[model samples]
Target: MLSRSSFLAVIATIAATNVVAAPFTYVNERFGTVCTFPDDIFTDRQPEPDNGDGQQWLSADGASLICSGILNIDDDTPKGFVAAEKASSEPGYKVTYSKASKDWAVLSGLKDGNIFYERRLFGRDGVIRTVWIEYPPAAKSKYDPLVGAIAGSLKAR
Candidate 1:
């Protein structure tokens, strides 16, 4: 039998092990896009693309998160971007929910059987900052709650 204090200490250790790590901020140098995400959940950071657009991270369980920025060559607005996403013809791309304001747009739906959420910020610097996350439907309960925080942190630096 364990002493009372020993039992409490063991419980605390277990709880600490289960606690998720704090999020880490990622900033895109090329376009000044910024976002935050829990690095423990997205452990594998892929090589940055040669174009210096942004970064991609992958979870051990097949989920992915991408934080990127692109030149707003088309001079797109939030509303127009949302409309273009809805009309996208990419294979297995479907937008079930969408909202747009003057400076931001959000889209959420199924993509290739996985749940995907995307947020974009229209920056004054003629750049569009974006954060896109996708996870398996089976892990919705695990991931759905975190998406909002991740998306909320995406912005122009």
Candidate 2:
């Protein structure tokens, strides 16, 4: 038998849990894209930066990072995948996963002891939307779920 105050406390806890799990959208009209992120846990790395290219963000603890942009290249997802592959082919990058579809390209790898995940979505309007999230391998358990949520929330509008 729960007392009235105890029942109210339980309700409050549930409400807070729901709010903390809610996603927030990072929108850039210039890029014609929107990405979902965790609430109040990430801070914009470039709050006043130009939206022409994209936006960058950092975890509140600075242990993780995220960024997204739209490039002006007139190409399809294959081209974007090639570009991503080229970019990740740099000195210390070791690809852990890669996949390409008609509309999406993903390249994830471990570099310099850090984990990096990148995805590119091809828009029919000749715009390439790219997103990147990075965190130390040691922090993957904490950051992976949040990053995954953000990646899963990306959409072209």
Candidate 3:
């Protein structure tokens, strides 16, 4: 019973509602690490840690995104970091895929039954900038496509 223009307007409104919002950039003051993510997906921003090392954001459905930096005290290279992650004893942590270059490393696999993707950049400032994103396996189709953009946005100042 709706007019043609009214029907089109309603459809447009619905489409707009389904669209994800623009991404937000977070920069770590201490280590100069930077990350970008869609804030609408990670709606709950947690309190910044006292050490000023990083920031974390959570979604309503249990997904989490962490942007952090750590001192490269051990002078670890990308390959060494990947090796260390693969050797981690953390319960339910398993690295199924890993790749490392001269200055960056990426690890993806299951962690506590959830899918996790992590990207780290070795900065010239003796800091390792990292972005870690994790979500339920059931939401792989939803989150997987967005991971690349989020991970690619990680950098160091």
Candidate 4:
């Protein structure tokens, strides 16, 4: 038989596990994409009009942002991403990762003392999905993984 203290410890562990927040999947069927994000970071989400394609999430402190949207284009997915890149208005934009054939690209740069990371993916359905994550440069280590998760979660239907 287990000791009383041992049983209490096991109960505590189970309770802790239950306290952990579960992740949520945000799906936009109109754009044919799904994104998953942890429930801990962003505390508020509001629907925004993106010409019928968009969503936004705000961090608890409101210091960070995550947003996604879609744009209609006639070009193929790859070309659509390329065209979007060429049309970027960010001065001194630097591409951190890019794959034209994959129809995905990640670009980052410092703007107004804040680090801006943008991941863009073009779908075969003539819709382009873009995820933008902005946070202070000093918090890169903390936010980078979150950015990766949100971007990777995006899947075309």
Each model's number of backbone clashes? 0, 0, 0, 0
Error of 4 at 112 (Å): 2.7
Candidate 2: list runs displaced more than 4 Å.
Answer: 1-22, 72-76, 79-88
Candidate 3 residues lying further than 4 Å off, grouped into runs, are 1-18
Residue 87 Cα positional deviation in candidate 1, in Å, after optimal superposition: 2.0
Error of 1 at 38 (Å): 0.5
User: What is the model-wide C-alpha lDDT for candidate 4?
Assistant: 0.60
> Tens digit of lDDT per residue, candidate 2, span 46-154?
5636546667777655555454565656455655665667666578888778877888777788877788887777877777777788887777666665555556556
Task: Provide TM-scores for the models.
Answer: 0.86, 0.73, 0.86, 0.67
Q: Model 1, 55-117: lDDT tens per residue?
A: 999998889999999998999999998898899999999999999999999999999999999
Residue-pair clash count for candidate 1: 0
lDDT, residue 137, model 1: 93
Candidate 3, residue 68: CA error in Å? 0.7
Give lDDT for model 3: 0.85
lDDT of candidates 1 onward, in order: 0.84, 0.64, 0.85, 0.60
| Candidate 1 vs 4: which has more TM-score | 1
The residue-by-residue lDDT of candidate 4 on 66-123, one tens digit each, is 5455665455566566566766787756444445557676666665666767776776
Indicate the TM-score of model 4: 0.67
Cα lDDT tens digits for candidate 3, 45-103: 99999999999999988899999999999999999999999999999999999999999
